[model samples]
Target: MSMTPPPGWYRDPSYPLVERWWDGTAWTDHRRQPEAPQLPLTQPESPGGGGSGRAKAVALSVAGVVLVASIVTGAVLLRRDDGSGDAAATTTETTTETTTATTAVSPSASDTPSPSASTSAPSPDDPSVVVDELNGITLPLLDGWVRPQYVAEHDIVMTTPGTYDCPGDPGLCRHGRVISRTVTANDEKSPKALAQQDIEDAANSSYDRDLIDNRPFKGITSHQEVKSGQVAVAGRAGYFVRWKVKTRVGPGGYVESLAFPSSVGSESLVIVRFAFDAGSDGPPLTDMDRITKGIRPVGDADTGGGVGSSIGPSK
Candidate 1:
């Protein structure tokens, strides 16, 4: 039986000029020319039949140079045969280090973004004034009007001094009282219905009766009259009426009511009342027109015209 040499570089059986690598039991593709062995140090023969020290030193130097050259060539062959394995391993280690660093810096699940620092400005359509602490409705601030006060039940009042507060010289009363009220509407409400309600409400008011009963002169007769029509108040088409009561003291300052009927949840009536002395220096009818036109629901901009601007509800 023939025994095989251990796995290593050996002279090729087929090619005489190169050696091939044997892996344990099999021949591998790796092949290279065998590295030449370095010459052994051989001293020169002197006349005495033995080399002198100088000659031995020179031979040893030459042998050392050849040995270094052989070692360099063998190292090159070893590295060439190793192929891309080393570079691939180095690249894999570098990739692993980069991956570890990235994972360490990544944000965790508990991280949260910081909140913004600035406050926002007010919106143009937002309401500046709120009315009725209970049944709150909001609107923009009205020019030329004082702060509103919740006075009577279901009523919020605001007024211009020159109108509601006549210049003291007037013997009777003043006007320009802009009163707002939210009232429940009857099922058959229309522009005419608003006018009728205004007439009834004014005729029953104590203020109207007192003005009629307390006559500055005894001969004057007192009577209640309501003049109503479809007037556009605050760009809204609704029933507007002027309630006038003539007394001995002259025509009692008229009570003007402008009704804006629209649905808000289940409630459907928004009434604005204007009371001013007809004889005293009071607010003009135009002022009443402006107030009604400017009115808008909370957070809603004026949509060109107000409630029922084109036509009244179909009767």
Candidate 2:
């Protein structure tokens, strides 16, 4: 005769100390729960008749993830910006034909445009001024200085004879070369008047326009003024009228400039510009004074019909 278990008790008397009884369909109720816990109900190996092969696949996936993470970590260390020097250095022997000259002004002075008494000008549309005549360009303005060498390049507008280098280097491989082009009084309006307008116009006229409008040209960060001739270089007294304008250049790439032309001459306008990137290296203005003061125009002026020497312009 089979003995039926008690209503709440299904005793496994194999090692009977206290019995684990059934609570309805399962052994949930116990006289005293054991300290050495039993294996859980959800620990079934595989319901679909499989080994731990499924677990092995998951392990392999985790391993693959760790391997990929390792590879990325190695590459990142090699490509970091910390002390990588710029990409511009390695490929071209650190020499560029269109390098810029950069430096600073002295404590006794600054590159800043100082307040000065204004110089009055003739009317913009005065009949006495003939616009197009190459001869229309004032002559006496460059009387003492030599002729500026005209080179048809984008980075150069009109440079007196001198050497130009990039931001920090002593002298970029190119030496004894200067570039310039014909400037019109039509754009300038006042053929005789030497002002920042003529300098800005010269900057925006040719390939250098993209160099400037697209960038500070020197990579400066924060600016307080525009580029006017305030910072006077030795043997060349001048100022850099600073213009902090919002240009179409990329973000934080504003423009700053300073120019110094001989007081009265054909090559009387020298312009210096800086294009600043907020996140990059500091600007090249630290050694700019030596480079700018180094600019020297060669040859006498091609003054037109005695109009420039005696008076400013024909008009």
My TM-score estimates for the predictions, one after another, are 0.44, 0.27
**Candidate 2 lDDT (Cα, whole model)?**
0.27
- Judged by lDDT against the true structure, how good is candidate 1? 0.39
Clashing pairs in 1: 163-175, 175-276, 234-292, 234-293
Best by TM-score: 1
lDDT of 2 by residue, 170-240 (tens): 21212222222233222332222333443333223211221112122222222344433334332233444
- RMSD of candidate 2 to true structure, Å: 31.3
lDDT of 1 by residue, 1-315 (tens): 223234454444444344444333333333444566533333354666564443433333322112243344345434423311111221001000000001111222222212111112224554344343222233334565553321111132455432121121111222445556544434545655765555434432313321112212121134445466665433345677766544333334556666655434554555666664455454565566555555654335553243335654422
User: What local lDDT does model 1 show for residue 82?
Assistant: 35
Clashes found in each candidate (C-alpha, N, C closer than 3 A): 4, 48
Looking at model 1, residue 238 earns an lDDT score of 69
User: lDDT values of the candidates?
Assistant: 0.39, 0.27
On lDDT, the leading prediction is 1
